[model samples]
Target: MNTLNYLHLDEKRVADVVTALHLLLADFQIHYTNLRGFHWDIKGHGFFVLHSKFEDLYNDTAEKIDEIAERILTLGSVPSNKFSDYLKVARIKEISGVTCGSEAVEHILSTYGHLIGEERKVLDLAAEAGDEVTVSLMSDYLKEQEKMVWMLTAFSSKTCGK
Candidate 1:
């Protein structure tokens, strides 16, 4: 009774996926904000590289935020739009004051780790609901993100010595 079932799907079964998507949306917003901070805060060596990288990340994060919010609407639920709501539900934490290039990249990598896991969980949920749209969305995001993780790791090797 709580769902609109516009897609002629079992709204009950997909509700869990909807809930998970809401959490993903919240986490993405926080992640986006953190990247914005990193873009502005990074300094020292590799500043040119990292600053632009952070900007690119935040721009992509903004697109993800829209995708997730729209997915929630597609699932017949409202996406949380407030920062207060985001902080309450997001597993990704807010980070700041990290101006070091290595540290900032490390933070972004760590954040991506958390996001990738969550996206997998969402993928499972969507598959269970027979939601191919959600599945494709997550799959694409995962592919792009995994590549980003690898690239960032490689980029960090020189400075972090990892």
Candidate 2:
């Protein structure tokens, strides 16, 4: 029996938090899986560079997933991890079948862009509801996602000579 009083979460706030948790988790899973694909099948002039970059990105994404799940638990709610659960909650579409390296980047850029937009929505929702923890988590997460989106998109352009 815990003596401390747990915070009372409003119904709407809880729902929003759950939605954001699931959405962020989905982003993490997609990024992690896509990075693995890029690392394995990168057959370009910049294979080594891309491989190392993807490795770092995937590792960081895995850490964020753990942190996001822990934050959800801190709110006394379970974070969803089942494939079915993710599929239902994730705003990002899964890449079907086989895709080449360059094609993978296309999918990643589109999905990452979508995730950046979704993170903004979650951040706004948290702020409006006065959920400081969720707001802080989202603030940090959004910055990282923005940087990743920039890097991922840069690889799709002429600046990288791709």
Candidate 3:
């Protein structure tokens, strides 16, 4: 008898994917809050550009958060909803009261770095579970976030040693 989930993935592998998904959900929640803070608090010469960008980021993250929760449900797991739970599972910490545009951007980059790493782990887990839906979703997120990281890195003053 095959011990597979309704989605046809191995039950154990589905459990692992669900665990990673919960972590990813927590990370997105933290990131969403930070983006909102940056949107509201940003000030300086780059304020106009960064303020709008932060709004866009938070909006996008909100959609991703919904998608993540729905995906968790599809995997037969419950998505965590409380902020306290998010704080416990998220690798990214809450960033508050950051007014400087550069500082906020730097924090955004760092948060994205954590998210990218976590997404990679989830991608691998989904692949192992033969979960094509999750694999596709994570792949799309990775592609978009990798571009965001590149663009944000370029916007910063720091440069790779030439």
Candidate 4:
């Protein structure tokens, strides 16, 4: 039987999983901040509609940030809390002053793309390590994010008209 940091996973596998989780955590942090910016700065003809939508998106991202950190701890590793660390590891960059509704929606879709990609990597790692908890988490996240991506794509199309 393999053991890692008093857990039942192989040490190397756990390390790999922890690394992936940390990367995901960083990506989520960046995405969260970008969503917050969108919520606060978004303006246009759709202000009334997009404002509330951005609020909902940021709130959901905040919850995801907490969930990712908790999962890291569950894997016997510390989650990086520094914004600097997040910037370094995240594929998503900080966005600011995005007032246009279509621009914000486009950025949201791009951020989700990065997030889904990272989650896929985590899913693969978790499955290889037989870590069903992480696997389930990633799977659920992927499903939610993919649907969000689809919705955002439709929203970004010219049909929505900024």
lDDT of 1: 0.90
- For this target, which candidate reaches the highest TM-score against the unseen true structure? 1
TM-scores of all candidate predictions against the true structure: 0.94, 0.80, 0.92, 0.91
In model 3, the Cα lDDT at residue 85 comes to 94
Residue-level lDDT tens digits of model 1 in 122-146: 9999999899999999999999999
Better of 3 and 4 by TM-score: 3
Tens digits of lDDT, candidate 2, 1-162: 211125545656566776677678877787677677777777767677777776887788789889888877766667887877777767666654433556766776777678677767877887776677777877887788788778777776766433
Which tens-of-lDDT digit does each residue in 27-67 have in candidate 4?
88888888888888877688998989888988988998899
| For every candidate, C-alpha RMSD to the true structure in Å | 2.4, 3.2, 3.0, 2.9
Question: What ordering of candidates by TM-score runs from best to worst?
Answer: 1, 3, 4, 2
User: How many residue pairs collide in each prediction?
Assistant: 0, 0, 0, 0
The segments of candidate 4 whose C-alpha lies over 4 angstroms from its true place after superposition are 1-7, 160-162
Q: Per-residue CA lDDT of candidate 3, range 1-162, in tens?
A: 332444567777788898999999999999999999999998888899999999999999999999999999888778989999999878898989999988998898888888888989999999998898889999999999999999998888656775
TM-score of 1: 0.94
Off by over 4 Å in 3: 1-6, 158-162
lDDT of 2 at 59: 89
Evaluate all candidate structures by whole-model CA lDDT and list the values in order.
0.90, 0.72, 0.90, 0.85
Model 3, total clashes: 0
What lDDT, from 0 to 1, does candidate 4 have? 0.85
